[model samples]
Target: MVAAYPDDVDTLVAHEPPINAVLPDAAGAARARAGFYEAYQAKGTGAGMAAFIAMTSWQGEFTDEYFAQPAPDPAMFGMPTEDDGTRDDPLLSQRSWAVTDYLPDAARLLAAPTRVVVAVGEESAGTYTARTAVGMAGLLGREAVVFPSHHGGFLGGDFGYAGKPAEFATRLREVLAD
Candidate 1:
């Protein structure tokens, strides 16, 4: 929105956007993504989530060693081993790849009047989204603003992955106020 209608936006806070092109090994990330999707298609949500977790939790770049690792077991992550026989998951499927594959236009963003604040969770250090947030900030010549909790910091307990939503909101308010 900032790129197309910069004047319309006052402040744009992009929190941990998973833009793979920002990563050093974007191709490897895509391969890793395919690995998870294959797992989802072959097995189920459990296996796919396990692979996704493995990919996201990886500390550094997706190396050959990363690919060489054994396929993550759904049971290891307390996920169901049985296949639900359904696909079309927005997260585990190729449908969401466009989101991660987007290459931000730095020139247009920099030229915009909107204050583009790229945010990363404090607990998301060294993770894929964290790196992307930093990279996005770098593209705009700024540092990522650290928020509380993990990737879904602003989310409540509804998703079974509760974060510091109150604190996150407070911090967001602070940033927006600035």
Candidate 2:
């Protein structure tokens, strides 16, 4: 974004971005992120996905105790236990780490001719992504605007992880309108 539109822009709405550019707990977050990869390497896709799920759903700060905890069963989260013979779990796979570890150019953003609105879900308060959103906004000297539902708030489907997309859109429109 900084490269493409550094001189001309209006508003940027970042929703639950894994931004650690100015996070106070950057090192801790990095360690916690490494734990997911460790789980994948040490165990298997199932265990790694489980750890990834736990990491994203975590309520508070990542700690040593969090890393020391056992991985939960994938079945509990509707994940199959049978060896699917597939390593592409998408979000939990190795390819996603670079995106997660991406640190935005804070200086470029701060000096940009754009208004940035950091957003997080109300239902996602205290979770890892929510914290990141808040942290990113703090770096911009603003507060994260809470939307109506969880991370998938923009999605409306009966996919078991459904969120209030209508209300989320309403809130998002409100934020963008500002």
Candidate 3:
């Protein structure tokens, strides 16, 4: 949207938007990218999803034992462990490397009139998404704006991942208003 309507938009609130342009380590980046595919292919939906949960929940870069880490239980997160004998998962089915691997056009972003405020979850300070948000903001010559909750901070009662949605919305509104 920024590319097509640079002038039409005013402020962009980027909440943990994974812009990989500024990731520090290439090897670590590749490992993280392959994490989901390896997990799902090796352990089916239940365990793979568990692995995915583990991956995203990681506080920092994937450790040396990341791949060896036990698959997380979907039941723990109120997610369905049993695959319904179908392979149509929009989230896990495809390796959309393009999105996570994206390196946004920093020049265009800076030149555009839109004010991009990168938002990161307070609890997600050391996580990959938070790091990525910070990286993107740094590229834009700014620090990410802190929000009230975690990565899913704006989420409320969805998939057992509860965040301070009301507070999050208030903070977001404040950012937009500024």
Candidate 4:
């Protein structure tokens, strides 16, 4: 997968029942601290803090999405499918299904000689989109390449790790030449 920080994001993003529901702000912070301690007990302070930040950020984003969706019920709200069997519980089936069901289709697409290129940014260390790209590549049995950027197009600005269309065209030409 194109994950900048695979382990941390996956842990936070995979949690069921949503983090906000289980821990309030203070409790959440406390739990994060404890988790950091446990995680870094052997690794070091940097690893622990990184885990804390990743989990906390994931909690915030997931909480926002959780609150934005309708209340619990299969027809209205549920766990995202991609996360369903990955976890032991079920909350939003439809959402989970939507996220998990794309594998076959993605594999089919990647199987074509369409020059699939999975790009990751140097800065998106713990973002879900980056993680998702990496995961999709793995599922498709393809290798994802990391591309460093500076400002716009594929190499810079807020475009993240996404390749610019023009850059892709040029890269395609180079590939064909070889």
**Top candidate by lDDT:** 1
Residue 120 of model 2: what lDDT? 92
Model 4, 64-171: lDDT tens digits are 443343322222222121212232212211233333333234544444444445444434434433444455455557544443331122443354335355664464
Off by over 4 Å in 4: 1-107, 150-178
Q: How good is model 2 by TM-score? A: 0.88
Order of quality (lDDT): 1, 2, 3, 4
The lDDT of each candidate is: 0.92, 0.79, 0.77, 0.37
Error of 4 at 20 (Å): 20
Tens digit of lDDT per residue, candidate 1, span 112-141?
Answer: 999899999999999888988998898888
Q: What is the lDDT of residue 165 in candidate 4?
A: 51
Off by over 4 Å in 1: none
Report each candidate's C-alpha RMSD, comma-separated, in the order given. 1.3, 2.0, 2.1, 16.8
Alpha-carbon lDDT of model 3? 0.77
Query: What's the best-to-worst order under TM-score?
Result: 1, 2, 3, 4
Tens-digit lDDT track of model 2 for 1-178:
7536977668888899985544576777777777776766666677677777888888777777787787778678776666555666666666776767777777788888888888999999988889999888887788999998998888878777889999998998898887
Clashes of each: 0, 0, 0, 23
lDDT of 3 at 104: 83
Model 1 has an lDDT value of: 0.92
